[model samples]
Target: MERLLRIENVTQKFGGLTALNNVNMHVDKGEIVGIIGPNGSGKTTMFNIITGIYRPTEGQVLYQDEPITGMEPYLISRKGLARTFQNIRLFSRMTAFDNVVIGMHARTKTNMCDIVLHLPRKRREEKECEERAMELLKLVDLYDVRYELASSLSYGHQRRLEIARALATGAEILLLDEPAAGMNEQETDELLQIIRRIKELKKTVILIDHDMKFVMNICERLYVLNYGVLIADGTPEEISKNQDVIDAYLGEDDE
Candidate 1:
């Protein structure tokens, strides 16, 4: 299996607080991996570091074996790394389709001169982006609501639309933060299907979720974190039985 992303001895600190302490984890191509822990176990902190929002205080992040730590967030996105936030950060006034089209900006090729001159290149690019955006919307099962304002969609639809937008960035490795957080059972089931479809596209996914059933059902591998430390990493079965994970986060309700 080819490793697509690696976090080697990554330690992140905010003044006196250590949000992540010498954590090590990796994701291989075409895998759905779960990062699970209690509320502040550095799950989002890990996503931030990987997406270049915050540079780790120690160690490095490797993508396809190339160091990408401290790279600009836009540059990382251009390199095919994209993510969705725990809090939905959509443009409330914009249509769902437009939101997805905007995500393709980093990957689109059109200069100001071409756009200003109404050049064929610009027209062609715009058409292509629109087509791709529609396809992404369809992927998330939001094609019917493509013209709807993001703010008007249901919470589950909004979350799925965010996934489509992330996919529009041409990302091969997607970091999803708590995608199942605000979802009901039906919506969570829909998300599971969507993520499986993403893997079918050969994309790698790393997700954080408090829903054990969802995580165990969807993820092939699991990494358990607690208080900024990596306590365990293995298959779902292994993690379900990890004593430290149980003591720290899972408790008696892991099943």
Candidate 2:
């Protein structure tokens, strides 16, 4: 498999506290990896650092086998790395279509001269962006809600909208934070289908989620973290029966 991302001995600190300690991970092309841990295990912090929300205090982050550490979030996004927040951070006042179109803004090339002159290339570019936004919305089955305000949609729909927006940014690697949060069984099942579709569409996915069943049901590999370091890396079945993992979560060696 082709290498897509790699994290080598990354350490992150916040004032007197250490959030991540000597972490190492990698994601191969076209793979779905699940990250799981107890709260305060640095799961979100790792995502933030990788996506350029925060620079690591030490170590390196490589994307497509090239150094990408400390780069700006927008730059990373433009490089085909996009992320969804643990909390939905949509433009609440904007329509779903508009929200998605905004994600493509960094990639849309239109000069002031072209805008003032109403040049065909500029018009076509904007039109193509809009069409692509719509296509992404359609992919998540949110086309009917295209004109609705994102805040007015149900939780599941909003989550799907976020994914659509990420897709609109032309992400080759998607970092999803708790994709199954606040979802019912049916909604979770739908999300599973959507995730599979995204993989089929050839985007690599790395997600942090608490739902064990959801993670085991879809992810190709699972990484377990506790405190600030990785404790296990294996298939679901291997993780399921691991004594250390059981001890970490249950305070006992036997599961």
* TM-score, per-candidate, Cα-based: 0.96, 0.95
Tens-digit lDDT track of model 2 for 1-255: 899999999999999889888999999999999998877888999999999999999999999888999999899889889999999999999999999998888778777987888788888898899889988888898999999999899999999999998888889999999989989999999999999999999999999986678999999998888888889989999988988777777752322
- Most accurate candidate by TM-score: 1
State the lDDT of candidate 1 residue by residue for 151-180, as single tens digits.
999999999999999999999999999999
Which stretches of model 1 miss by more than 4 angstroms? 116-118, 250-255
For candidate 2, give the lDDT of residue 8: 95
lDDT, candidate 2, residue 1? 86
Clashing pairs in 1: none
**TM-score of the candidate numbered 1?**
0.96
Scanning candidate 2 in windows of ten residues, the lowest lDDT window is 246-255
